[model samples]
Target: MTVSELGLLNILPILILVVWACVLLLLDVFVFPKREQVTPLLSAVGLVVALIYTIPQFGQPKEAFNGMLVIDGFAVFLNVLVLISGLVAVALSYDYLNRMGMARGEYYVMMLFSISGIMLMTSAADLIVVFLALELLSIPLYILAAFGRPKMESEEAGIKYFLLGAFAGGFVLYGIALVYGATGQTGLTGIVEAASGGLENPVFLLVGAALILVGLGFKVAAVPFHMWTPDVYEGAPTSVTAFMAVGAKVGGFAALLRVFMIAFPSISVDITPVLWGLTAATLIVGNVLAVAQRNIKRLLAYSSISHAGFILMAFVTYGDASVRPEATAAVLFYMVAFAITSFGSWAVVIALEHAEDRGLELEDYAGLGRKRPALALAMAIFMFSFTGVPPTMGFAGKLYIFRAVIQGEYYGLAVLGVIVSVISAYYYLRVVVVMYMREGDPETHSEGWLNLTTAVTAVGTVVLFIFSAPLFDWAAQAVLRMF
Candidate 1:
């Protein structure tokens, strides 16, 4: 494409974000000049503006910059979701950061930068773009994770996440190099064409694919690659943890689905078995391990891992062109639902934490219902929804995925998912039980402004189920255009 064409197609979104980030950085450094003065308000407004700017491109498929990036329904859908989640995270972070005494404009800037990476990731069709976006998303997160600089736990979480994340990035880059060598191409379209032409040397291609999967596996926190999750979730600031859980998962899954479904579809036979094994192991290990955790954050981290397994079930059944639409829609809807519910859960934890100590333990939640009825009610909704109870979006998400798996004749995986959902309920409901059944500590009091987040989350959780049909339809339409 000519420079003018590329500028028209690719540069809009990229330029919008670049300009936005630069402005925010300038305001933070020169105008605000103090951490306390830099509010998350600017970040929120910028994201909203970005979302509005990107919304008009939803139905058009525009590829630019030598076809390295494609803006289509799928990319637009994921980008909108990421932006919404980022906005919510920033809103929740304002109070949470101030309460924890970690309020800084850099925090919001880093979040926006990570969000920019997520938006780029979903649109990336070239290996170089994918690697660049991944780093962009990850580097900001590393600093955000460690933004609680003076706190030992925060520093530890940041260091551990950075070390592991860099290692995973290496694996991903190596895999890309191998794939490039095998196929003599670095774009998804090129790789797909090369694979279809019959492999002159399948060794490098297969190994590259495996390494890529490993790298992404760590990002999504699939089993065996999930050890860093619990500690990181427990130690990092709750807002960052929430963002990591929801925003990171959405971006990771977006890139993963694009790479696997479009670029490497022919390798289903090899990839399917591996994913099946990972799914089974993740479900078993995540739920089983969660049963042993008294720390609510850690429990939720494991829960998130198990949920990843559930999402993978959709991919396992994604081969038939007829079922692909439903499968993809199920995964997308599930990600959205999980994001809302998980954020609500963490917002409560962050809000309730005492100034002297982060209050994430199950014991700390005791008598929460008695002390703060509104917060307790919100937590109850999140817990119940997470457990796949009726009338919540989580149940609807699980039901759709399970139904899709069965329709594709994956009866065993479907049954396994159902069984694990039951097992997950025990731990999820434990928090609810403690809130309602226990007595309150005489000294404990509810934190302020957390109610705003809870209220928003609760409404989202309920409305998601009520409006799930339209959301599913939108996702289905987006998936149909993916081909």
Candidate 2:
């Protein structure tokens, strides 16, 4: 009952990252004032340290900070994933920022801060903590989106993201208040316990959950709330777009999985239909709209939205107690698959991007196969993975998700996923076709870290699938403690 009893070490990974970000912020101002390169390296080092701290705590399930946070397999899995994402972002940002004349130490600092928020979100056990974590995760992203100062597009992206993000935050906060009003509890476990005993205002609870879903749907770029995504992705710096694509979705889904599965299962019957509609609409809209885009970033933005729909397919079974663990595991695995494939694709996009944002059109990618065969091959692999082709992690991820959906008896959703995935191939392969089948000189940067990121992620996307069973088992283990 006392503050002294609140375990702190249980969340050491999050703490280390938060403290490191603060220290790095100061170091950026004084020690590395002129060295843009040093900050990213240091940022990567901090993320590695946090990852090390995280990996050791995977099996030790416990609550901390007065039950506001938890350390468990799920938390550890996401913590490690988020940390790795931060490191990859650092690598991608190292040279690109300097090339575009937007190199600033604060860029890395903001990323570190945002990543720490993601780490916190994965472990949050209370609604209050989830709201705090959501804000911490989002605020830095708004600033980072605008990091390319004076550029009209970047400025517009930042402001639009900021305004919309704040509106989404309002939805979450109001939902939290309503949930609290209905159950008089903010802790997820307590909310479930209170609801199971019979909520006096179950309607309030249902509406609140819907509002929270709306807010998170925005974060994951689900349809009806996804208007901000394409503009932001196209306008923001490529490195920021790459990181934001993965990090924000992970954080949003983490909260969504935890809160809905833990706190709202008692009312799943009322909410299951909503999840189904979101999944179908998001999948259909994301892929259908993407076919009309010529800009690569916008296409990938829609790709991100469609992938979110695929993840939502697994989440559609959140109400099925018998299939919940399997669904959770499928979602975790698919996130890893999506992250690897996404980063690799974006790396190729970044390689081809120029100072004034040339090389971004679909036509700009023509002849990339002849000019940069390796990068082109990597892009092809990424595109294939996105299309759910074999030997790639995306295929494995979609397989797991469809199987889980089938197990949950959501055959229609699974079938829709397949058809849309086929639709997605049209645009995904268009890039590859342009690269190999057409003819236009494509200029690309051959930065060491950038190339390494593309190569490693491209390799990981394939290699991990070959060993997907163990990886999936690990993901399964992560949610064993949840229920």
Candidate 3:
């Protein structure tokens, strides 16, 4: 096939996701106004369809729109990861939404929109496309966080996210403009050529790169830029929080990888110091603050921030050499591991909360094992994974990332990562102890399927670990071809 024909094939996934999202929006607004909803089911189907379409595209390397977007192993790998996370999110939302009395069609619609943006982030080769895709993913999340309109906390979460998000957007746009001014181009390939020719304006390039990093730092919740994370995660609906933890992190990392790998390869050393500092600070701050939280959701919020720091370490190892394959693979693997664990953890939290009482406090989980052994066990599994315990997907992911860092001779960062993982174990295990060791109230009883997503997510955690090698191989191959 000709190059244009190849490019057209590569673009199919984005087209399919957009069309599916529009159809779901139409069905939700017109055909299902009075009905409870089938949007979640349909959203799952869409993800499955996307995944099926993506499988055939693996190992194919093609660039489209004058090198504005690329399809290859990396894009396909991350696309599959995003779609799987979306499917899991949809499944987890069913019971949680029903219990919250917010099981509307719009929630699913927003999810589809967010997934489309994630896919875009994976392939976008231009700065403008990156910013647009970032906004597309974030705007829906802002609304979803505050979907509980009457709740003060929900409203606060939504507004805070929106305001900060808008500021980040402006920063990203300005950065893009400055980079374009410096290199006379917005395309990744063009920027790389300019940087290579030694004719680009160094001052403008530096400033633009700084601004871009600042903007993306906010999205990934790095230290100093993570002030909004705790409150937003606490106040947002549990399902949305879970989605943000998994999907947002995946998308943010994808954008980070694309920008650094394609647009600013020469400055990896210059940027590495800044990223190292941010990663260390984020890891220490998130884990330390999490130890003080009485609320489960808030604790997980901080934990998610710390996890972002771990993922950022991969960027620290990124450089002009081919070593990025291992780093990129590590990032992708960790995201999948985190997605399943975080999704399952939030599912348990949502299942625990009911209409009369939203038991988000850590104390409320006392004796859960006695009342709901199955769920308690599931929660324990998620906690184990999050703590990087053995035989879980989380452990495997950490091994891959830390190995990459060590291979890159980033011994200090790798050591700090290990230390924080140890510190984090205390808090994650604390929840498990509360569930199994403490006693449940006589009045409390486990509700049926109010939050059954925990079981589903827990199963996914186990299965992911069992198949982790193949997944890692696929991700490694994908990143190798991308560069």
The candidate maximizing TM-score is 2
Clashes of 2: 0
TM-score per candidate, in order? 0.97, 0.99, 0.95
Judged by whole-model lDDT over C-alpha atoms, candidate 3 comes out at 0.84
Winner of 2 and 3 under TM-score: 2
Worst 10 residues of 2 by lDDT: 1-10
- Estimate candidate 2's alpha-carbon lDDT, on a 0 to 1 scale: 0.93
Model 1: ten consecutive residues of lowest lDDT = 441-450
Candidate 1 residue-wise lDDT at 66: 72
Q: What is the C-alpha lDDT of each candidate?
A: 0.85, 0.93, 0.84
198-221 in candidate 2: lDDT tens per residue? 878889999999999999898888
Q: How big is the RMSD of model 1?
A: 1.6
Q: Model 2 compared with the native: what TM-score? A: 0.99
Question: What is candidate 1's lDDT per residue for 330-364, written digit by digit as tens?
Answer: 99889988999998988887777766454767988
When 2 and 3 are scored with lDDT, the better candidate is 2
At residue 141, give the lDDT of candidate 3: 91
In candidate 3, stretches whose alpha carbon ends up further than 4 angstroms from where it belongs are 1-8, 320-322, 442-452
Q: How close is candidate 3 to the true structure, as a TM-score?
A: 0.95
lDDT of 3 by residue, 47-163 (tens): 898889888988768777767788778888888888888887887777777767988888888888898998888888899889999999899999999987788888999999999
